[model samples]
Target: MIVLGIESSCDETGVAVVETGAQPVPVLRAHALHSQVEMHQAYGGVVPELASRDHIRRVLPLAGQVLADSGCALADVDVVAYTRGPGLAGALLVGAGVACALGAALAKPVLGVHHLEGHLLSPFLSQDPPEFPFVALLVSGGHTQLMQVDGVGRYTLLGETIDDAAGEAFDKSAKLLGLGYPGGPALSRLAEQGDPAAFKLPRPLLHSGDLDFSFAGLKTAVLTQVHKLGAELQARKADLAASTEAAIVEVLVKKSLAALDRSGLQRLVVAGGVGANRRLRAQLDAACAKRGVRVHYPELALCTDNGAMIALAAAMRLQAGVQQPSDSYAFDVKPRWPLDLTAIA
Candidate 1:
């Protein structure tokens, strides 16, 4: 089966094609992505209107590119899949609309996939894919969660952020340091030059004894530190950036370990944009290695929002018999769909 996936969740427009064979796992044939980072950079964040308009302009060309790269024709696609929720509504609509229109035009079935599930199952597309019954740390844009996964569509929410998520903490803290848009990467780049021990930033709920996370207080702590730095902030900015990244990384690592211990799972899969963080990956590798646990992550390129994960997820769900594609052309999107809502045994 060939699955064509479209993703316009926020600042990126992505399209890809994947094929399933006798094996349960599907393989990515070709994928293409266009980042709106440079466009959003001017505004220090995404502007919903501009993002939607850009999606309108980019999705189809990218889809054509993926088809050409994969040596497949639009008529040859078996299923059309698109991210259907938990993103900017306008952005989601552009992808959903185009996907449904294609399905209607091709007379093929269409599937609406949960955006988070795309992130959750993305590692399956990697060279070293994870097996079932593992723990997943999904640290996407505004979401930070730990889930117990038994298989496709089977998930138990172990814990999640109560306030600001880890990504938010990174972005917000970087803003405090006068970093440009896409704060996480900027802060991490500067962090390479300084010491994490130069300043002490709070790690919220590191000892809460529960799996839930809280980073709002940590963001506040960063603000306080920035205010105190005053005129000296420029000279010591790198140190502060390093310290801030350290605090967020520590919280994420500790909580992840706690979730693994609580779930008694030996395998960990980290997904989402924050999962791309070098500090988080390095620390988790060391910590999990010490515990004799196996840790998995999507290829660095797939760590961000992309069409490959979306298409791979749809293929897996179809293979598992958990999701049924529709012949009806009518389509809608859920801007706030929860992952657990699709959880099934």
Candidate 2:
């Protein structure tokens, strides 16, 4: 089966095609993505109205590109899938509308997928895909969560951020350092030249016993440090960045390990934009290796929001017999849907 997926959740417009049934995991045939980072850079963040408009202009062209790249025609798609929730309402609407319209025109079924589920299942598209019954750390700009994933659509929320997520801490902290838009990457790059122990930063909830996360206090701590440094901020920027990244990575690593120990799961999967962080990956790899635990990750290119994960998720859902696409063109999107609330088999 061929599934055409569309993703317009936030700042990126993505489209892709995936072929399933021949392998245990769906194969990504082709995918296209257009990032609005440059466009949003001027604003220091995403503008909901601008993002919705850009999605309108880019989604179809991206779809065409992926279809061409995959050597597939419109008629060959067995299902049309799109991210349906936990994002900007306008952005979600654009993809949902286009997906339903295409499904109606082509007379094919359409499926609405949870955005976080797309991230959670993304590692299945990796070259070294992980088996089911693993722990997943989903650290994205809008969310940070730990889940026990038994299989497609079967997820138990282990813990999540109560305030700002890890990504938010990174971005907001970078902003405190006068870094421009897309601050996380900028801060990370600068962190490479400094010492992780250069400054003290809090690791919230690291010893609370439970698995929940909190980064809001850490952001405040960064602000305090910025003010303390005052005129010396410029000279210590890289050190501060390194220290900030260290604090966040420490909490994430410890919590992830706690989740694994609690669940007795030997496999771990890390997904979402923050999962692309080099420090997080390196630490997780080293820690998991010591315990002889297998860790899985999507290719770096797939770590961000993309159509490939969306399409692969839809295919896996169908293969697992937990969901069925609808023939009816009428559709609605849930901007705050919970991943654990999705269909489970």
Among these predicted structures, which one has the highest lDDT? 2
lDDT of all predictions, in order shown? 0.93, 0.95
**Ten-residue segment with the worst summed lDDT in candidate 1?**
336-345
> What is candidate 1's lDDT per residue for 100-135, written digit by digit as tens?
999999999999888889999998888889999999
Cα misplacement distance, residue 74 of candidate 1 (Å): 0.9
Model 2, residue pairs in steric clash: 86-335
Write model 2 residue lDDT over 56-175, tens digit each, in one string: 999999999999999999999999999998799999999999999999999999999999999999998888999989999999999999999998888999999999998999999999
User: How far is each candidate from the true structure, as Cα RMSD in Å?
Assistant: 1.0, 0.9
Model 2 earns a TM-score of 0.99
Give TM-scores for every candidate, taking all chains together and pairing residue i with residue i: 0.99, 0.99
RMSD of 1: 1.0
Candidate 2 global lDDT: 0.95
